[model samples]
Target: MFKNIYFVCFILILSSCGKDPLPKPSGELRLEYPAHKYQSFNSDCAYSFDYSTFAEMQNAKQSCWFYINYPKMKAKIFLTYFPIHNDFALHVKEAEKLVYEHTIKASSIDTKSFSYPEKKVYGNFYELQGPTASNVQFYVTDSTKHFVTANLYFNSRPKPDSLAPAVEYIKKDMLHLIDTFKWK
Candidate 1:
């Protein structure tokens, strides 16, 4: 009789010791961002803007624009869209020059470091990388009245391998934006 009573008490205690279930994430956690967002550039400018809310945006000091922050992941996404007046080939050459300049500037203390050119995305443009920044730059024009570029930047010190997943996520979002992009 005593053994039976003890066994029941032990079982009861063990069952009571089990932890309570964790609460589920709230509505905010459940919310999902659209694949992308599109914004026409200011009426005076010949550009357009598209990005994912997965990152936050802020303005930069120079004509080059703002900073995009990914706090939880400790990363940044940068955009610098510049207007060009030169011919397409010249604009592309200038973009390459800018990449070289950035690489030299970033690697001033370490001449051994090098930057590389990345293949164009969407098959019609080009991109370049520096020792300190990875850039995705491409030009767009409708044959007259507008010539602009969309440049995406990220710190190069961090091996892209480490940030690949997040970068890919953002890239997919950006790709969606590009696919649907239309000048206003």
Candidate 2:
């Protein structure tokens, strides 16, 4: 009986040696983005803009159409070019339609108009919030000869909370591109 009692006490002491079970503390992931560096993208197309060195440029099937692919982020900026042969309004409408299509999943969309009279660049920048498949879209044109539309897409499902850092980093780069855009 004494031996069994000592065994029980030993087991009890051994069990008590472990610390109390505790839930893990909640934490957010920390994402780091590299410093921004840009290079001039020159093509035989109607326009030229500065693109990030971090992104790889791929030739699209159509002339003047290209993709700025970020392999590390698994994101891409698609650029489509159309020559405006008295179809400026149509091109603008088409670009707007594409952005509006995301309204079903987007919580909100904010539009910013860009105008550079000297450069002849005019367009709207759309920033979509929530779980929309695309977070940003924009269209720029000289309103006479060249119309270009751009969209940013990620390969993975968009969880804004997780993608916030990458999104913000890319956002600045995109804005830089838009600001420096020149019609050739």
Best by TM-score: 2
Worst 10 residues of 2 by lDDT: 25-34
The positional error of residue 99 in candidate 2, measured at the CA in angstroms, is 0.5
Overall local distance difference test of candidate 2:
0.93
For candidate 2, write residues 32-150 as lDDT tens digits. 87899999999998889999988999999999999999999999999999998988889999999999999999999999999999899999999999998999999999898999999
Indicate the TM-score of model 2. Answer: 0.86
Model 1 stretches astray by more than 4 angstroms: 1-44, 62-64, 98-132
Q: Give Cα distance to truth, residue 110, candidate 1, Å.
A: 27
Please give the clash total of every predicted structure, in order: 0, 0
Off by over 4 Å in 2: 1-28
lDDT of 1 by residue, 53-158 (tens): 6667666675645565655555555545445355656655664565556554343321121111231122123333333455344444443334444455554454
